[model samples]
Target: MTTALGLVAGVLTTASWLPQLRRSWRTRSTDDLAWSYLVMLSAGVGLWLTYGVAVADVAVVAANAVTLAALGALIALKGVGRGREEAAR
Candidate 1:
């Protein structure tokens, strides 16, 4: 079914980032992460979320929504860490 396929695709795409998320959380380090790439990915995910809503795609919406939240948290943490480092200098 198309819905199942979409769900699988969404899952695969979203889950692909979990390892990095876990690593970042565990190490409490975003040092190796690229800020530009993360910002771009967040924006891309936002668009995907919008597309999902537009097309009434439940799988896309759910997957992108969760990914956005997770990435957003990571971005916030990175920003705060960067700010602290900059302040310390």
Candidate 2:
């Protein structure tokens, strides 16, 4: 049951980001994404990771680990890309 739930959660969260990620990649524009939100979200994910570790929950740890990395990548790339855009202008 726990494994099932983990599977569901993993699929749901990963799939939820698919559309936005795809669009951002294709358009090469994450300007619509809010930096503040991502910043806060990354912090929250960090907390989630810590909590998962404290509780010794593998699913929580694994999911948050992968998600945190992905989200962090997006945030970094978006900031860098935006900066480049500003400099180019």
Candidate 3:
């Protein structure tokens, strides 16, 4: 039961990023997103992944892995988009 609960919580929190990811991909606009926030979030998620691995928790491991992927993509897109904007100027 605890594992199940953990999975549910993980899914919910992980899914929270889906919409933002989709929107950013579609629009190629991360003007509203903060670089500092994404950097810190990715760092924090990395720590969570490390903790999950140490603790051998499937839910934590799975969720943080997926989240880190999403965050990575978002960060890449933001960087590329910013670069293009700067190049245009």
Candidate 4:
């Protein structure tokens, strides 16, 4: 039951970011997203993934894995876009 609860919570928390991810991907707009925040969040999620792997918790592993991927993509998009904007200047 605890594991099930964890999975449910993980799903909810992870899914919460889906809309933002989708929107960012569609619009390629991340001007409002902060670089430091994304970096810190990615770091924190990486730690959670490490903990999940260490303990062999499927829910944590899955959630953090997907979250990290999405975060990585967003960061890449934001970074590249920012670079392009600077180059255009």
For each candidate, the alpha-carbon lDDT, in order, equals: 0.88, 0.83, 0.94, 0.93
Per-residue lDDT of model 3, residues 2-59, tens digit only: 8788778889999988998999999999989999999999999999999999999877
Candidate 4 Cα outliers beyond 4 Å, as residue runs: none
Q: How many residue pairs clash in each candidate?
A: 0, 0, 0, 0
Write one digit per residue (lDDT tens) for candidate 2, span 53-84: 99999878888887787787778779888899
Report the C-alpha displacement of residue 59, candidate 4, in angstroms.
Answer: 1.0
For residues 11-50, write the lDDT of model 4, one tens digit per residue. 9999988899889989989999999999999999999999
lDDT score, candidate 3: 0.94
TM-scores, each model vs. reference: 0.84, 0.83, 0.93, 0.90
Rank candidates, TM-score, best first. Answer: 3, 4, 1, 2
Residues 8-37, candidate 1: write the lDDT tens digits: 888988887788778887878898889998
lDDT of 1 at 66: 89
Residue ranges of candidate 3 with Cα displaced over 4 Å = none
Candidate 2 segments whose C-alpha is farther than 4 A from its true place: 1-3
Residue pair clashes in candidate 4:
none
How far in Å is the alpha carbon of 83 misplaced in model 3? 0.6
